[model samples]
Target: MKVGLKLNEQFTVSKHNIVQVTTFENEFHLALTNSEYLVISKDDKDNSYYYTHEFNGCLIEVPVNEYHRIQRELTEYFGVEIQDVSSDETKDQEQPEPTA
Candidate 1:
């Protein structure tokens, strides 16, 4: 399928309700809002790298190299900071504090 057609399908089913699509650094970036975006690109070798972002709930399929390239571009362009959260952090927050 053509890249445009693939992007259309992604927009139709995206949970974030993609409102715009643009190209940056030769990759497609689908925007749901100013703070939320999804990047898509075609893999040069396998053409089957697919994954979903847990936070934004966006689906993406692209070449491994393109994935990293676009990720960096998105971060830089949007000034987004990607943080790693441990499961322990969530567990600690879920527990009630001890009463005095």
Candidate 2:
């Protein structure tokens, strides 16, 4: 996930601009001007599709294959790790207590 990025670099993720790289879903989400979201779709063929979504956009499509890579890039660029929700935590929260 470490891509050797510096925090002071212009490419660094900031409050106004963020490079949302979704690794598990292999997609890139760019938050553009207000009400605009740019999504980059990655496929097995290495084909990259660009999409623009407005505030009223109905649906968002994120390619599954490029998710992992996207996440890695985001982490590298932001110098942070994406916290994953553990299955054990989910089970613990969902299961009811047994009677003593």
Candidate 3:
């Protein structure tokens, strides 16, 4: 299954290419079969994320905020459920409480 992912750029990745998708609270990671790691930040206000790939000793950053979208697409594409490993505490309020 070709999963359509829209990040900093458009991408069509095979379901097989992605070994698994795991999340720890806001952090999301994708383990690829090619030993490449894709990380997505929990930032939505910036509409971006910190994505890097060791491309010949160079780390290219890809700003992406479509984490949920990508997750949904991948689940739908592969017909699999996410094995959430986060606890209730980890799902706490995202915004920090302002202090005077």
Q: Which candidate is the best by lDDT?
A: 3
Instruction: Give the clashing pairs for model 3.
Output: 49-64
lDDT of candidate 2 over 1-59, digit per residue (tens):
44332222133334345534332233345564464544444444343233334233222
By lDDT: ranked, best first: 3, 1, 2
lDDT per prediction?
0.50, 0.44, 0.56
Model 2 stretches astray by more than 4 angstroms: 1-16, 19-30, 33-35, 38-60, 83-100
Lowest-sum lDDT 10-residue window in model 2: 4-13
The model with the greater TM-score, 1 or 2, is 2
What candidate 1 gets wrong by more than 4 Å, as runs, is 1-12, 45-59, 63-100
lDDT of 2 at 94: 83
Q: Given candidate 3, what's the lDDT at residue 74?
A: 70
Superposition error at 82 for model 1 (Å): 28
Residues 26-80 of candidate 3 have per-residue lDDT tens digits of: 5557777888766655454342333335332212234343556666677786688
Clashing pairs in 1: none
Q: Stretches of candidate 3 above 4 Å error?
A: 10-12, 44-65, 83-85, 90-100
